[model samples]
Target chain A: MDLLRFITAGSVDDGKSTLIGRLLYDSKSILADQLAALEKQSKNKEDGEIDLALLTDGLRAEREQGITIDVAYKYFSTPRRKFIIADAPGHIQYTRNMVTGASNASLIIILVDARNGVVEQTRRHSIIASLLNIPHVVVAINKMDLVDYSQDRYNNIVIDYAEIARTLGLKDVTYLPISALKGDNIVEKSTSIPWYEGPALLELLETVQLEKDIDLERGRLGVQYVIRPQSNDLDLHDYRGYAGKIASGIYRKGDKITVLPAGLTSRIKTIEVGGKEVDEAFAPQSVVVQLEDDIDISRGDLLVNGDHLPQVEQEFEVLLCWMDTKTLAAGNKYLVQLGSRTVRGLVKEIEYKVDVNTLERQPAPAQVGLNDIVKATIRTATPLPFDRYTDLSVGGGVILIDETSYVTVGACMVQ
Target chain B: MSKEHNYQLDYLDQLESEAIHILREVAGQFERPALLFSGGKDSITLVHLALKAFRPGKFPFPLVHIDTGHNFPEALDFRDALADSIGEKLIVRKVEDTIQKRQLTEPGGKFASRNALQTFTLLDTIEEFGFDACIGGARRDEEKARAKERIFSVRDEFGGWDPKRQRPELWNIYNGRIRKGENVRAFPISNWTELDIWNYIRREKIDLPSIYFSHDREVIDFEGQWVAVSPFIRLDATDVVETRRVRYRTVGDMTCTAAVESSASGIDDIIREITATRTSERGETRIDDKVSEAAMEDRKKNGYF
Candidate 1:
């Protein structure tokens, strides 16, 4: 079965949690014991009915405070596909959580309450998803139940979101009217809305193609370890292979490759998985590849096919999301870890801050505080082999680390 | 070169690859490392990934189990069997030994659990072995506080976790650095959820303890958790026990681990149950965590995995 990772982003009252609860419940994906526990807890609540929001609100603090503080993951599957849904927080302060959730997802589902149309958080999440290059976006105009399943209400949200999607350069945007609370247009087609013609949310999730979501042609590999068996026997002596997961692309025997950092060149001699030799390996596969030359390859170095080289540079511009309370100032040094390599970097300049609501950019202020979005230039101590964030999602992102405390202060999408 | 293997790789294969990459980084970045094997499905999964990470040779580090001295007998046997099969060194440190040595105190009463007590033994073992990196099979989805933990989480010299001071783990280039007496707990399966663990166990065909499958065992319904009838358990006047077909969602201390009544006898059945369960695996199995809102966060702050 195919795997599809998607992120759900919405405001507190937009019924994001209810949608997930209904999806799991309607599909019979929920266990009896869990439902029993929820029912028991719901009985104690003021509503005296099963609060579907209690399903994704796993933390006691979240249930007590009625807010999601961190990203909560929910798993469910139909016959065609298995999904890992990142239930990210919709509050502006929790925007970092949204980025973290959508960072590895193939698709993003932005829930817009049909009654509210397109709100600010909706635009903010859509922008981040686009900035993160989430391949597909499904704007589920939720709470059609509140709007009496009105086609006009859903159409308004679609039109409002379309303008924002165009400004964000988002492709493959699909709109659907859904009622996560009452289970309309969620698992199966809604019989109440005769004017709608689109497939149900679950059906779209099952059939949406993800062939181009991930890069499979760059053939990039980051060496994680060098393995050598200790034996004096002549036949087995000096057997060394560099092992790692293919971060992107594919490789085969006799494929010309270059090792990064040292820039050494070699040809792939063999690829082995569990002592058995294979002729080829590709992205995300854990295999040990032996090279013809005994190059000085070690951890922290990347191996890529020789013909296609990522940009090697010391300075690059990034669309950064400042996560920590401390403000970002010029001349501040942070550890930038990209792929397997970590280098000291200095913030050289702040280009501008982004206005999430109006889809506009403003002049850079003196500092970028927590939850602030800005474009900045950072210079690394050593050159890094990277692709523009737009070109390669895997190679272009960097996490800023505070040197004194070693805390990840911010995340940057390299431009 | 041999002909292309052309083997069909599944989602588990991708997850395993990511884990192996993380494991190799730990091996390379740290001066001393150890794998925290609990003989449970998740930790065992980590061991399998480590074996594949450094194949054609023995493991680069020893496997350590912070034994609570209350584990299922079958799980302990399985742990030993796995170590022997892989030709890797196994280090077992028991909480009972710590209590007997007066290094730690045990909670009194039949309902008491040694779940929190394991932290002392784990920290002691890390110091005794001088291990800088302790790799575990903890997944973020298992608990709320864990969900906030960084994959390469840093612990202070006292083996306490300061959530506010956590290192930022971005991408796969994990930084494993610390001052003297400080250590890092590396969770390779941080992304894998409960269902992923079951699916991986099925896909790899890895052997697990018999208790994971349905079997007739004496159990008592205690405070919404299924307590197995054991010598350590204290049967209250009101508590009644009977034999039931049950399986463990999580393997923990005997005093704390709970079993669920189910007729699911195999991995496939367990996977199906896991898929359908709304309550978290820990919610049903972990008695220690049910005590408070910050139960996990509090324990993790004190260096418990």
Candidate 2:
């Protein structure tokens, strides 16, 4: 089955957990024992009702304090696609967690409570999703039951969020009116809102085009490892194949490819997966590629089609999100993990701060603090093959590390 | 050594490759490294990937198992057999030994699980072995506290985790650094979820302990969880006894590891059941985590794996 990984974002108490619980319960995803446990916990509740939130709130403190402290991943599958949901904490303190969860998500579902049409948290999450380059932005206006499932109330939220979506360069903006508490537009269509005509949340999830969302035509193949058999058997002896997953783009046997770092050129002899040879390989495929000649290739090398090579540079500008408690100051050094390669980089300059709410770029900032978004210039110790993050997110990003502490301090999106 | 042949790789393959890359970097970055293998499916998968990463050569690091002394027999047997098959060095440290040395003690009865006590043994092992990096198969989906952890989580000399001061991890780059006597608990599978582990095992055709598959076992009711009726469990009068066909989704201390009633005798059956189950795999088995709201966070801060 095809995989569709998505991230959910909302402010605390916006019913994000409840919505997830409803989807799981309505889909018959809850096991018999799990439901029994939920029922048992509900009986002892101060308010007597099945606290559906308990299904996702697995932490003990979360149950007592009634708040999510960190991201919680939940998974479920429809026949058409298997979904992995990264349910991120919505508190301002946990903005780093939201970015981590949505970094690789194919779709981002931004939950907005209809009672409060547009809040700071909604805008923050929308900006983060857009900044992360999540292709599909789903605006789920939850708690429509409180508004009596009124189309006007739902439309107001859609319009308010639409403006933000457009500003963020989110091309695929989908608005769904869902009431997680009453099971409206979550799993089944709610007859109460007959004026609305759209597919249920599950159907939309099943039919969403995720394969096309990833740009296949534009990406460099980063070689992560070389797989060779060490034995002296006749069939397995003297084997040397460049083994690494294609970080991006497609590779054909006859295609002329350039190996970066080594600066050598060769034609693809063949592609092997689990010892079987194939004709073609694409982005994110962990296969072993054989070159026609004995080219010098090892780990941490970039392989690109000769026709389209990524920029090999030592200096680049990037939009960075500071995640560590230690602020980013000039002249600080870090270990950058870009694709399969690790290179040392120094902070050159902080250009300007991004106003998430206003979608405006403010004047140049002196330093970037925790949760600050700014454009900055970096100088790497070695040339790295990369593209603009907007075109190739997998190959164009780097995580900054504190040289002294060795912790990841921030995430950088190459411009 | 086979030639570069054509093949098709999936998402799981990509995840595995990323994990292998991290493993190689850990080996190169740290002076002395060890794998915290619990014989669980996730850790087992880590071992498999490590073998793939450094194939044609022996693994550079050894495997360590912090035995709580209150473990299922199947788990112990599986751990030894797996290590023997791979010809890799295996080190077993027991919490009971630490207690005997008067380093620590619990007020509870002998039947009480040594789950918490294992932390002392683990830290001692790290100190004794002078390991700078320890690889584990902790996934973010297991609990909320883990969800916030970095791929390379640094622990102080006291082995305490400072949540507020964790290093940031961006893209695929992992940072593994520590001062003298300080160690890092590396989780190569931090981004992987419970479903991903199972799917990888299925795709790779890796073997696991029999407990992971369904089987008939003697069990007793302990609070709301199903406890394996082993000699370690002190059953009360109200505790009902039953023989149920069940399997363990997680293998921790036998005293706290609950069993789920299942007839999933194979990987395909288990996969189907997991797909349909709404509750998380961790929720089905872990009793320690159900204790308090901040159970995982507190334990993590205290350096409990």
Instruction: List, residue by residue over B118-168, the lDDT tens digit for candidate 1.
Output: 888887788888999999999976766776777788898778988656554
After superposition, the stretches of candidate 2 with alpha carbons farther than 4 Å from their true spots are A28-69, A91-94, A119-121, A225-243, A274-279, A290-298, B1-31, B51-57, B188-204, B211-249, B258-290
Measured against the native two-chain assembly using Cα atoms, what DockQ does each of the candidate structures obtain, in the order listed?
Answer: 0.47, 0.31
The candidate 1 chain B region of ten consecutive residues with least summed lDDT is: B1-10
Worst 10 residues of 2 chain B by lDDT: B1-10
Show pairs that collide, candidate 1: A30-B276, A31-B276, A219-A249, A408-B168
Q: After aligning candidate 2 to the native by TM-score, how far in Å is the CA of B267 from where it should be? A: 4.4
- Which candidate should be chosen as best, given lDDT against the real structure? 1
CA lDDT, every prediction?
Answer: 0.82, 0.79
DockQ of 1: 0.47
- Docking quality tier of candidate 2? acceptable
What TM-score would candidate 1 get against the native?
0.92
- Which window of ten consecutive residues has the lowest lDDT sum in model 1 chain A? A40-49
Cα distance off (Å), candidate 2, residue A174: 1.1
Positional deviation of residue A132's Cα in model 2 after best superposition, in angstroms:
1.5
Per-candidate TM-scores read 0.92, 0.87
